[model samples]
Target: MLQTYAMVVNRNKNRTKLSTSSVEKNINVVNTVKNPSNENINKMEQSKKPAKRIIGTKIMEHVKLQPDKIIMKKKVFCLSNVKKCHRDDVVEFLQSSGINVITCFPVIKRTDENDPKAINNDEHSTMFRVCVEKKDEGKMKDPEVMLQHIIVREWKFNEKKLDFKNG
Candidate 1:
């Protein structure tokens, strides 16, 4: 009776090992089917490349069709009375105040000889040309209101005229 019991225990252990091995093989086959190999993944990525290229080309074509619309979206403004500040200092000050200055230069205004306030020397002032986006153009129209710290003598929006020559 003792021998028969020992033989039964050994048989159960062997059966358990065989079943576990078969289960591991089945799991490997399922994983392979669900997750593709590297080569298959590469092929799928290559197939998606052309679709992305087509989308990029469509965007470029749309931009080319309406070039004037893009030009109208941005406005240029000339800011005067920069207080004879250096070019770098003016740019840094404007940048600190959240103003995007495109170009800056010192402008010498000719003084009128007849005017009582006119000086003998040329009046030097720094001028800044800034490109403002359409969304912010309205707010930036009044430099005195927008830039409270800076002394603004004059502010004006630059007008751009399109000239087309007919052959």
Candidate 2:
């Protein structure tokens, strides 16, 4: 069996590495555990690891946890009307006019908002990611392109949506 180490804290708040037994000394203990369950270990490890992202849900089959988050590459995409095949129009219009189009700029989570409060706190945050596939992509980046093409409305998306259960 593999042994796990626990840390002990002193009155001065200094962390000291000690053996499993140190109670007679009247020392303060933090995370004092002889053996923790595998689940606890996993939670501790996951906190240290960065958030994992996946392109499509199909890739989630390899792991027990489904990768609910989405990730997009360096392509610029425009989502217009569904009837217009929003995917193709945005890519086409941009490239035809010259803006270094990537075509099919997959709708992934936008990294603009580092904190979650920015979305929920706002009074008028009209579901961005929901219509991301039908929103403006390069408008935020390139103003000149959108300025000229005023006739066509562009859709933009931000943030990834998560699923949760409620009673």
Candidate 3:
């Protein structure tokens, strides 16, 4: 059977209700004689219809691909040495501590001369995500609340800890 099956798939099914005034909703089917050679030729010609290209308008121009490079400049801290120390004391200590008072700050990949260079050029980059650290006083005031803040607001994540082979 040689019938033109025109399936005018509506682009906006839910966003725009298809009123009788919106689109010229019509189906035109024409059946002709059955001929194998002619049908195959027709199908071949149909396949050459440029694969239904989507040409965007001037206002909706194609977007350029974004580069993988990212900069992480936000400051955050990681608490350390809690044994034999009270929570409030620790928070206070961290806020006004001594030299090199170790706390986690965001660090991007730095290629120093002493370290081995990345084997894959594209794969290895010094890009890091922004991280947020709550104030020590805010955290100590409500531990659970601070934890929730960290869970929700913290942007930096441990990417190296992922087990890629299993994944």
Cα error of candidate 1 at position 134, Å? 3.5
Q: Residue 31: error of model 3 in Å?
A: 36
Spell out the clash pairs found in candidate 3: 78-104
lDDT digits (tens) for residues 38-107 of candidate 2: 8878988789688886555354346677646645444333332233223445546556655444334333
Model 3 lDDT tens row, 1-167: 79888889877875856565423443212123233467777996798577664533344346685436633323444432223333334334434532122233222245543454433332322222222343333443445533233322233446767565885
TM-score of each: 0.33, 0.28, 0.17
Candidate 3 has its poorest 10 consecutive residues by lDDT at: 122-131
Backbone clashes, each candidate: 0, 5, 1
- Candidate 1 weakest ten by summed lDDT: 51-60
Q: Which candidate should be chosen as best, given lDDT against the real structure?
A: 1
Clashes of 3: 1
lDDT of 1 by residue, 47-78 (tens): 85655322122344535354333333556666
Score residue 167 of candidate 1 by CA lDDT. Answer: 13
At residue 28, candidate 1 shows an lDDT of 84
TM-score of 2: 0.28
Q: Residue 86 of candidate 3: its Cα lDDT?
A: 32
